[model samples]
Target: MCPEPSTSGVSPPVDAVTGIEAETDHENDAFSDYASDVSDTTSTTSSVRAYVYENGRRYHSYRPGQYLLPNDETEQDRLDMTHHVFSLTLNGDLCKTELDNPQSILDIGTGTGIWAMDIGDAYPSAEVIGTDLSPIQSEWVPPNVQFEVDDATLDWTFPENKFDFIHARTLAGAIQDWPDLVGKCYTHCKAGGQVEISEGRANFFCDDDTLDKSSKTWQWLAEFRKLSEPLGFDIAPRLPDILKAAGFEDVQLTQKHVPLGTWPKDPKLREIGRIFRVQFLEMAIEAYSLALFTRFGNWTSEEVQVLLAMVRTELKSNKIHLYTYTYLNDLKRKAESNDSNDHHSPEKRQNTLTSEAGNDDPGDEITNNLSQDSQFLAASTSGEETLPNLKNPLVSTPSKFLTDFQGRRRFLGPSSTWAYSRHVMGLIRKYLGQHQPLEIPLNTDGTAFALEFPSTKQPGTTITMQDLPSRDYAIYLINTVKFHVCQTYHLFEEQSFMQGFSKLYSEGPQPLNAENKLWYVQYFIVMAFGKALLMRGSSEVNPYGSEYISRAMELLPDVNGLYQDPITSVEICCGLSLYLQSVDHRNTAYVYVSEYLQFYRVLHELICCSLVSPFA
Candidate 1:
């Protein structure tokens, strides 16, 4: 229960939303106000003050394992550094909202109270409140800013429909229930209040040949995800859907790329990269690992340190253009909106986990620099699309590949396809002759023209089927993608593809032979897509097939003569592009699209020179 507000002699701070003069006393009871708002069950007691120390690091005493990161001096410094990095990424803005004067704001998981204090300073008239499990905020803060010891997972008790804006950053691992947290924010917010959530995932990526699929850095991050997912930590991909389920209207998601080192030629991005490297090497790696690896992974502190040391070395190298993906999901609550289903409906919540923060931008942001500024983009699922069921019988799937729900418009529904896919199919149809039907082959029988597989430049170092799904599972996945997902207007012909997959799966546990290298990547992507689309309710098709996608990507350049079968390259690119897009990997899909065009030009030249056959 909230302690009754005592009437004071001094003029009360005006309630910003209702324009009512609320009775209040701040001097004697500062923490309790923000504290009571977030946690109803927990009190302002000494138990929260209890601190735990392990592995030469510190963690919160209350709900000790709810959060993965430590709450210590080094961790404090990292928190502040993270705020600076986010500020830089957002071009010095405290947030993306345009509210000129927000009355009351809540910052969840406000480590060290840096963002709260900064936001308080930004809007001096507005009262700002920050909450965290640990009371580590600075003693001296702006008059309007207050630090509270509260847990977000608890029932919010301050008041319903109260705050003007709520902000939470990097809470991927802190809150166990993302939907529950957002639902609370939506409820406690005033009629038009807004919420912003910023989370970054360690999904490492590279455009060039520098970062390998087998790199330890990739392996280490993958390991962390594998372990942390059981605890419900991964965030970026599913946040948008979760927010919408909470009835947050006009939800928007933006993606920003942070390089591991100074690799970007753009001056602004280079600066971001330098600081980004410090963010990882200085404290992030250690702060991330000490608790996670030691406790859950059952590994000694020394082993974790040695692995981190090697990771640090790799991060420092300029050759590798390593980078990570960060996302911001911003939304607003409507005044008259009725609570849709139970904000925590189990079925709706289950559908959200597979949803990705899908970007509708065709690679323009990834390939170019708009003055090198990080831009906010509306997600593909941000708006609703409704179109009458198509009555035309002659309209083939290939003809509609380039369009969304409505062609050349922002009206993107389920039928929304990438521009690259449209162009690739158009070219394939043009060459094969408008009247001739397309035949997409799947077998590695080596019985057709442009079919003889080329030997690898270095066969010993070639990528083979080492880590993949079992034979039966692989067959099921291929069948799932049989009629579509071939390499040009690309798709897998059922019979031939089944024949190839049968032979490939016969190898049992042994690594695939050298002659099967091209077939290996093609088969790998087929299975990757198959499993990606076939998951009954898997949280992420991404993790299930990430290794498959990564290996096929590695084999793209240098290893296999992908140009031998131009349509094959198109098939890989188109299939992977769709699969990547499905997993909310829009930027990487864009790169594959660029690769699709690069090979399309090669195939165009081959046609002119009479060196290759189109339907071969």
Candidate 2:
């Protein structure tokens, strides 16, 4: 019933695998002996002249540099990485449609045309057409697959109801009007056909309390969103609504939490996190930011680079557990029939809409109770039903509480804090018992314990610690409490501790007083140790340590007048000692510490009326 694909004006399709191999060979042969051919390729052909070349990458000249990123080999690699990520997320399936034999498929905004080629190979009998703005797709492709240079936002010239399946993914930032795009897809898809939309949430989220509002990564995301607002591409949680509004039936939404780094305990998630860190964070962040920040936000390239560097540091840190939600929407077009349709009228359809939030797995049919004039109706059925709400027939009503795949909730129950404390205290006692024998008093939760041991600094003296939990126990308590409290809560704010500090240092300081001076001293102490923690387990020296220490030293004059107080003097000395111990400096650290002690003595004498206050 369908016409064969015409190869009249189009390039002949090459074997898909053979194309990939040829590209790989070209890269290896060209790059092995010399650098990549970064020379201008715009004049290679009249069609290639439509692209703008910059920084060894090609950009779309049709929009006059509207799209910030390049369509070069680097971007192609990142697109492949995204393909892997999507494949893993969907459990090796491209779409959730149950169609036995889809005749025609359309892929919108299909960069690199990899997905289309793969689908073409999988279904040799089907025709797959991949459309994009650039013509950077490989010359070789599957016989049934074809690539065309087309902007998805423009009016599509394809015949009505031509495709059996339509798919669009990762077009969040590229689309200006998503509702219009969905409508176009609905118009082109055949009756009883399916449309699948896949997109990741634009904002970042964290289940653990590790990532807070003040993090550098959060700031970067805030700035990115601000610049992206004018582009009209902020569609994540609202995707399902848009699909349903486009006259599609049987809309289903699935949400998954994708980690940003390799910090998850689960092996599968850990691998995904690693790929995201390397492919997205390290390689693609700059390409995504460079033009947007410069043109839209008026930020200098150097300033953007500095901000991105800080973001990279935060992303690499295991202490920050971050993830973003990826949403998949599956919808179907109604079959043509003579039966009266409930949602045929736009007015009634708009008025009778209902919203239902789903969990990770499929659940019940959310019903909307409305008047007789309302078009929305709830229908529950098995797999045979046209618009079945449940994904699996065996999945019944979901339990009120959320559970993991193993069906066990690994969270703190009632009295969990007490139990955790007891377990930690037991471990501390076992480790510390070998050092000395002493009476250790237990608090109500058995966390606070006191032990007398010879001080490492002052070997002969026995130091008694009271009302303090052991270091290991404290860590366990913090982790347990955070895991329980932050399981459901997600923080989304730009103003935070680090942002405040950045503003203070970048801008001139306010009128310094006693309180403000003490705050500066405390902040310096905290940051020095924070850097130490971030640089742990590294074989090489931490490149950030010297810069951080230098910045902290700039605040030294703020605390100059407080040298008369022994507690203030002791705090500064202790902070300096800890910082000296943290960094691995050959000679610069000793020089800095000696200069600090000399400055402290001079300030002490100035604060005191005479030099005989403490030194004399």
Candidate 3:
């Protein structure tokens, strides 16, 4: 929703120069008792008007309806609700920074100026400027904070190297050229200044595998992407890279999974999710997109309204277990000074092209590695070559798996057995199509004999599964290989994997699950392994590593009735590809190449079958 124009023709509180009403002493007192003695220096000669009305909403006359959200009281209320949700998410803190005293702070796209006002109150000594396309800020504000109506995408008028801190949040669809904005920020910020960009991931996720391609929320996102693409806006998962390319250093990305409804077991997350569902999701999905879809995307208002209703209904479903990923990228402007070149210059453009080209192509590298691994496995299985060494060159020899410590052994050993046990239990429950929870009795050896079914027909009737060593070994091998990847690659800790495994295990089985239990488990393993390789700077020579990793990063659909899930196949293929990269780069390949290939081919066929028709 965009800001609305004032219904009244005349300005509310007339200032002689800027036509903006000068805030009164009473309004100032509402914000702070000890107001600053500084007088307002707003230029009376300025020609900017207060508001322009279009499509029944008020827009800033400065930019003249460029922003799509309404700045009316209703939208302001919605913004405040969103603010509450974020405040709860951050534990009532405005930000997670250690900067004790920032002399100058700037909040870009500060809707309603609530955040800016709070920051001003927190740091009374600092000068805080809130810039937005709408002049919807309240007349009563902290003396240290001032609101300005401006377009952030334009070249900033602020003096260079002035601001000590710059913050932008929830401006995902508002800005077009992010790199340009970041560059402008770099130029204007003081050396060592911090810039924080907070935005929610473009897509939603379901931990218990309820959401999928056919889900309403997923379809809504697809529609949103369709609308956003033409506006030069995208929810790219590469903010850190953009920040780095803009010459910001020490860039760090922090992520939090905010549930859509009150379904999480964790109390805090449940509360947050509840607020998000009530305060944001229910209204925001409709409010934020109505104008864009109608005006820009050629969508009929009725069509949009109907779709929004469906989306809202889906958002309210606790059974869905939906969540959105929110990410914060914190960066520091490089301290060293250098000659500033025009970003539009040919020389700068050429330099950018060269730099981009120098970066490894993840897709090409992964494909090459996969091909090589296939050949190597074929040769080894045919007994045409000796086993290849499979040790990471980056780390010291005698891998963590080779160590004989009890703690390590337990974590890398029986813990995998426990994971296997949990995976098998989930599969059994899934196979039986059980929606209600079931207790699986395990033997002392961490093996499950029969599955128990609590009868709904008879109060105490139960069904059980007998001993199945073959099934147990199959699950065990899959889990063992995953654990080996974690240990060998140093990608993820055994404890963390187990924690996730246990959490999923506790969820048991549900109907129409979006993630296959086994596939999802292996997905994380492959993701962690791929991530480890990327962290080791493997993308430069083996870009395919990044490609597989990227695919793994995305949410995977459930296997449903298939023998194997898509992600499991992807993981096995990725594992072999990684092994191939290791061999090509470090001349080390594990002896289990043939076994990995066989498993990968089988999984690949399963994926193909699932894709064709999982129920088949």
Candidate 4:
């Protein structure tokens, strides 16, 4: 019943970004050789029984070619991330409709069954069913929850007008015949059942209109929009009308701005955008394109990939303020109008995902639902903020999200310096057995109660010459770090870091200036991550990684040991911060992050102004 990730075709797409790969075959390696016989009696309980593969991805086989995206593990993870992003958009509430002791819950197009499982766990008494064309859900689900492989577009065998709640999302590109689908939803949902459908408009929008109409990002989207028209992917704008046409009453239309990256200024919105960045950059860009372009547009996989790479680069560019609108068309907005008095309290409609984990604290202000993910996320923002003043989103955004440290606000961290100092004094008092502590905000990723120790003391050890890897191995590690780490966090200046690497690894240990020494420390820190990624199979303390980090720590001790070169100092600080975050030194990593944000923000502002400034 389980569909495994491809055993091959895992080639990295570096050249894809450059759009220079030679053309070849079109068959996808993931499932090209795998095929299933047509059983006289096909079970609706599993999709692995039958499969269709294309362009290095998998898709639903019920109506094999209808849906444009894949149904593999990669797509499943993106779906979960999408769910988390939206949950955050609603401020911890799963839906706008307050589920009143829901007895029956139905999640349509339940990609990974994450939402269905969470709902099942929350409403123990409710009977929950998640239906999709793929039966990839885990075998172990809540007793009340179950999954079925049913084609939503075809006749659903589910009892009509029986569900108390029905929900669907991210079904933009997969859907065909929108009205019939809504009619079926209305037909199946109980008389007073609440239906929530969220479909983001299939096109991107720039409030500032800075995105050129002729840009690849726009051109590609316009191509997909026109191509997918016959397939009926443009479902967001017509969803409300569809619900109304289906005889659904009290339809409420709520819209959310789904930013494409870390472009929003609001603390929560910035966090949301950050997660979307990863979701789009790593996989969604290709996942959303490969099928539509090749199957419909008759473009070769290589050509589509080339165009997709250009789009990826454009999406990641800093010149645009782009976002898409996701509309929530709920069928029960009028359910609570009878009593204008608010009835849903935090205690009553508490979000269940974090409730059991004890993560929900109203006093904490911001809630990160993604769990060790990005926020700015549902857990990890890029770990290190390139912008120094991340905490001041409103102020920084109006000033074009200043990256410069010049004239930055004094208070930049989650908590102010005065508050941090108070915590320090409180820790000392507590150590002496006499202390009355004031309420302090734990803003550093909520990693610590107080900054007691910088981190566990390290041995005064150094990575000896004998411990260093060969030149080729070192280059491999650096490249691995670049693809895996640098692409995500943007750790350091490419040319400068490469130059440093060349100098340090040259025939002679270049005369050790302060700059050289600091670069040596930074290089070691970067190399540690290379070892960490490769050592995933083993959880034991990696002696080599430990040794590299220890030697770096021995040289620098704290974040950015030297400040002579502010840019290099910020780089050191970011590298250290990411390492600390990886090793569960989150609070310490946060401190490093807070410091670097100030330094990096200014540097970023200077670069952007230099590039785009009219006077320049």
lDDT by residue (tens digit), candidate 2, 1-616 = 0111122211111100110001122222311211110001122245643678754456776545545677765576567567756665554455545555576999987877778876765455578988876666655455578877777777678887799999899887788667667767877888889888888766555544455566677678768878776775557666766676557778776665566665665555654565566666645787778777887898988888899998876665555556655677777888873423334333344453333322322233211211111111121222233222322111122212224455432312222122333454655667787544335443222121121112332212211222222222222222322343334322111133234344453453545454455444434444445332322212122322343344445444424455444344445555555454333331333554476677677766665534423223
lDDT of each: 0.60, 0.53, 0.52, 0.58
Cand. 1 TM to true fold: 0.51
**Candidate 4 residue-wise lDDT, 1-616, digit = tens:** 0111122211211111111111123122221111100002225634544778888787777757667789775676567567767766665456657565668888988877878876765555578988877766654455578887767777678775578899998887667666667666766777677898888766655544446766777677667767876676756655655555445666766666666654454545555665666567666878888888888898899999888888766665444555655677777523323321122222222232123223212122222121121222122123133323223211112111112243221111121232434555666667888756556544444242221222453433334446565443455457557745774576777787777666555553554455566777778787777765433211222322555776666666443436445566667778878766655466767777786797667666766644432222
lDDT by residue (98-130, candidate 3, tens digit) is 454676999998877878876765555568998
Tens-place lDDT per residue, model 1, 348-434, is 555553453244332221221212343423322221121124321222231111222322112111222344334446667887778
Scored against the true structure, residue 163 in model 1 reaches a CA lDDT of 94
lDDT for position 5 in model 3: 16
Q: Which regions in candidate 2 have their CA more than 4 angstroms from the true location?
A: 1-45, 54-57, 212-214, 337-616
Q: What's each prediction's TM-score?
A: 0.51, 0.49, 0.49, 0.50
Which residue segments of model 1 deviate by more than 4 Å? 1-38, 41-46, 213-215, 340-616
State which candidate has the highest TM-score.
1
Query: Candidate 1's C-alpha lDDT?
Result: 0.60
- List the pairs of residues colliding in candidate 1: 404-416, 486-490, 486-491, 487-570, 487-571
Which of the predicted structures, 2 or 4, would earn the higher lDDT when compared with the native?
4
Q: For model 3, what is the alpha-carbon lDDT of residue 473?
A: 20
How many pairs in model 3 have backbone atoms within 3 A of each other, for residues 3 or more apart or on separate chains, i.e. clashes?
27
